[model samples]
Target chain A: MRRFVRQAAEILRGDPAADRVVPPTGITARLTLFTAAAMAFLAVFALALSLAAGRLADRWSEELARGATLRVSAPAGEMEQQLAAALRVLETTPGVTEVQPLTDDEQRALLEPWFGPDLPLESLPVPRLITFQETGGGYDPDGLRLRLQAEVPGAVLDDHRRWRRPLLAAASGLRVMGWSALALIFGALGAMVSLAANASLAANAQVISVLRLVGATDDYIAAAFVRRFTLRAVAGAALGTAVGLAAVALMPDTGDTGGVLTGLGFRGLHWLWPLLVPLLAGAVAFLATRIATTSVLGDLP
Target chain B: MDLVITFDNVAYSYGGGELLTGVSLDIAPGSFHFLTGPSGAGKTTFLRLCYAALQPTAGEVRLFDRPAQELGRDGIAAIRQRIGVVHQDCRFLDHLSVADNVALPLTVAGRDGPAARRDLDDLLGWVGLSKRADARPPELSGGERQRAALARAVIVSPDAILADEPTGNVDWEMSQRLLQLLVEFNRMGRAVIVATHDLGLVRVAKKQVPARVLRIANRQVTAAGADL
Candidate 1:
């Protein structure tokens, strides 16, 4: 431990620019900074997407699962009578919290995109619809179906299982893809850092050889490169994080606009999560440079 | 002082090309030996073996009575701390100042910085490079470079010093001064092995100190047994 400390101290003391904090010089510094900046920007998007997908999955699963739709497809004279009978039965049923019958305007609005602004509801054999919401203990699907069939022969109940299952599955898949993208980003960061370190090693071949000849071990030489790259990664990542967070914060969070793309930015503590990106980038740089340095220097005398 | 190196029937080759074979020798402590050979006679290779830089393909190289391969990198490095080497090319980090270059070995050995700062001035003075301490290696002359290499070699008061063509790039006066420094280290009970083809240097050292000459030929070490 004493020896390690001594070596660490010597590593810092050997380089005048060790902690001098001068403006970066050479192409490696510039390239490292640029890579870090671009990666951070991408990481922000990935983080936002992941968080949004997760929240979307939870919200869709919870809210959509608690509601069911009742469709009454009867002959021309009995459609309103069946829908009204089903609504009355649902309202009186146990665990049935609220029942709302869709207005003609609301039904037209739902069908406006596919049909038109002025839907011909009288000419078409469109089914009458009623939405049923449930409290904590939802109504039993089999029992409710039996009751609706007995009370209103043309009434059919949908617990939203078909639509909710697929939607939730898609949302969960989206969340997985988002996380996978983040993993790929980190892997790319490691690759870039390794490339930069190898280039620096090749450039400083003579310097490394001389230092080794003077009794510097491979660890000492590696520490120098590792420290330099790690610091660059850290500084660059911090700058990138700040810029990325600011960009994310500036995004408009307008409410849903009839299936329009919205809410692309971070919400709540999700913005703080991207702050760890720079730290992770620094760690990746540190490990990547260290591995490359040791491997390269190990091949040396 | 103790004899720190011994080679017995050591053979070494690179890329399947034999450079040294059937080499046997002993370096007594506090003794200075001059190695003179032709260009392809493996002088540098022999020096490398003595300093544990390379291991023999056959036979044995005992450094402090330990086989070369038995010592790990750290062990070799520790041994290197006590044995300074001066390369023929006199290489240095072009990015660092001369003082930093001279202080490199100390830093690698994990010496105290303040003590190195104090000793660094005296060391520069000894090599007559006090003024150029702040200059870079590329800015110095060949002679100054040799002196700096010498200063670096003896800075740790190593048990032994191995130099390959220490005066190859310098003038006669500088070569003589470098020789004088080696002699001084010898008087202070440090083993010195210098590999060079300079016949004049061998003759010059004959009058000042008792020195033995070794030659490499036909892949073997043979003592010349003569000062000149």
Candidate 2:
């Protein structure tokens, strides 16, 4: 283990002579840099998506947890009576801070997205929605339900989990998808780097044979390839990260909810997370080239 | 440690055929020897075994008195640093200059400092390649490349030098100069083994240095009958 660490350190420290052994121009050279930059760009966007989704989930969870709605549906003659009774019951309930029954026009606006703006609150037998705020100690739903069932029999208590859970769940899923995208971006980087390293090693077979003849160990040869590809990846990833950050910075922050227009770009210390892309890129290149070099050199005399 | 290379009944097979069988030889320190063989003979294979480039199919081949098999890949690499090899093709990194090519051994051994630079300059001058220092390997002439290969082999001041047709592409005069360099190295207490097809060069070398000629005609190597 110590030897391995020492070798890795030595490789990173670099030997210009060893580095020169590999010809600086080749398909692998350009391919590695371009691949790293492209992958890093995608990775930065994925990072932004994840942070935005996380913010959305947190805001929605907080807003949803603090309040719920009580809907009252009854015959036209008894609708007002049930609504009054439910409001009275809610006013007396412990931990219930404020209760306000939504007006007819407000109900139409709430249903406008689905039922259209001309929703006829005068004709349809729509249930009345009463949104209520709770204190830090929330009211007991079971106690409220039992009292409402006995008095205002048409009243239905909704804790709001039906829509809240799915909203929060969708947000959580978006965050996961963002993270999975980041993982795939890095994975593709590793695979591409490994392919480039393999091609470079094969192209430089004669160079390798000469180095081995002149007393170069497999570690020395491997270090040369690793140093080249790793540095290229670092430089490319830095470029990509810069451009990505700049692009994110220029995005319009429009909505209070989260998406590209609002919370997508990093805020405060969160900006530091994307900076890890280059270091991770270099690490991926190092490991991939090391494996490729070892495998190729093993087949030589 | 008495011998630089020792082969004990070593045999090697390749391509479904045994190229070398029951071959035993000893290369003592500071000795000068020539290996003469036909084209199909195992001369190159023997030189490779001497440098631990190939493991013998049977028996043992020891380098610096340590069994080649006992030395792992890294260990063999370290051992190879003490022994320099010059191939018939003068295998070089064509992208590097003549000076850098000559200094390749030191570079591979991780000694590319000022001291190594000084050695490279001196060696290039000795090989009459100082003027071509900046020229790449492909830019050099046949004689110049051979001289560069020679300089590269001795750059690290290895304990032993193995040459496979070191003068193959050069003229008689250039061959003589290369032979003289090998002889000088042998006089400096570094063992020299030259594998070549030119009996005339071997005959010329015998007159100047006390050397033995080993010929490989069949699947074995035997000491040639008289002083060449």
Candidate 3:
């Protein structure tokens, strides 16, 4: 780690004489900078998506795992008795907490979208919903079901397992996809930078021969090419990351209801991750140019 | 320690044919020598061997008392710093200004400080290129380019200077001026070897300095018995 930091510091310390050896304008210069910027721009979006998916996965797993609903359906005579018995059984349960039966107004508001608001609640039979929380370890759904079968025949426990499984799987898949996209973006960044470096080295082969004849060491010649490409990559990536963050910030956010599409951006401290893209781009450029020059110089007399 | 370069029965071959054979010589410190031969008489190849640019096909070429084939790439670079070479082509980076091009040796050696900068200025001025310091190599004429190459050669204060046709592109007056610069360097205790086809330049140099004349003939280097 210390050696790595030292190398980073050395790279940051500019070598103007060495850098001036290479020509100022070339196709590789524009190619490398453009590739790094494009890759970093795509990388920012992928990073935001992965983080959002991770948050969604954690929320679905934690919240849904600890809460359940009990629905009681029967004749009007037995419905009230069943709900009362279920609540009594839940209150005595070891892991269950915050047990409450929904009032008539609450049930009416929940059904108002499906059924008309003016429906007569007293004429027809409707089910009662008992909402309750659980401890961190959660209650056993099978044990609660057995108790409710014996005491309240009309009661059914919904541990949210049916609703949570697909949602959790979807969130996890999205997270994997987002991360895979990011990995591909970085891989593409490395490949494009290497291609540009190789082109630059080939174009400057005569210049390299001249420098070597002038008593320039392998390290000195490599520094001239490597430093130029690295600084260009860093500058380009910084611009790209800034534009990406701006684009993400401009995305339409519908608060909590927006789900996956709208809330696609850095939140809180996660904004700092994209800041490292330029540094990472510089690192990639340095490695690519170094490797390219080493191989080419080895072939030289 | 007294000899800058030595070739012990060295032979060099390329494409399965011998270009030079049975060559043996020693270059002492602060000596001036002129190499003269026919156009295809391997003068450039001989200079290349002195600087570790080519490994002799047989026998040994010792530079700074170390065998040329034994040194690594860095070792070769270190020896080159001690022996400055002015290529026949007058190669320059072309993109850099004349001043930066002349300071190429000091830049590569990591000695480009204020002292080196001042030396570069003085060296360029000595070569009559102080006015054209900002000009690139392509913009300079033939004589100017040769002068710039010489300035670059001596900018590092190299222990030895091996120039190939230093006055190949200049007039009689300019050639005399360049020869005087080389004679001055030889007086200051630096080994100098100038390879050329101009026997007149050789005759002119002998009057100014105790310059030895060598001729490469019959694939072997031999002394020219006061021929000029």
Worst 10 residues of 1 chain B by lDDT: B107-116
Worst 10 residues of 1 chain A by lDDT: A16-25
lDDT of 1 by residue, A1-301 (tens): 6654564465435564332212234899888878877887788788878888888888788888898888889988888788778888998899987789898898899999999998988877899889878888777889988998899988888888999999998888888988899899879988998999889888888877777677777776777787788778877888888888888788777754312136667767777898899888888888788789978988877
Model 2 misplacement above 4 A:
A1-4, A72-130, A133-140, A257-263
Clashing pairs in 1: none
What docking grade does candidate 2 earn?
medium
Clashes in model 2: which pairs?
A: none
- Model with the higher lDDT, candidate 1 or 3: 3
- lDDT for each residue of candidate 1 in B1-228, tens digit (9 for 90 to 100): 445898988999999989898888889888889998999889999999998889999889988878878988878887888889999889887677788788878876668378778898999998899999999899999999988988888888888999999999988999999999999889998889999999999889878888889988888888885446
Q: Where is the poorest 10-residue window by lDDT in model 2 chain B?
A: B101-110
- Reference A-B contact fraction recovered by candidate 1: 0.56
By how many angstroms RMSD does model 2 differ from the true structure? 3.0
lDDT of model 1 at position A212: 69
- Model 3 off-target regions past 4 Å? A1-7, B225-228
Error of 1 at B135 (Å): 0.6
lDDT of 2: 0.88
- DockQ-superior candidate, 2 or 3: 2
The candidates score, on chain A by TM-score, as follows 0.79, 0.82, 0.94
Maximum-lDDT candidate: 2
- Tell me the lDDT of model 2 at A14: 76
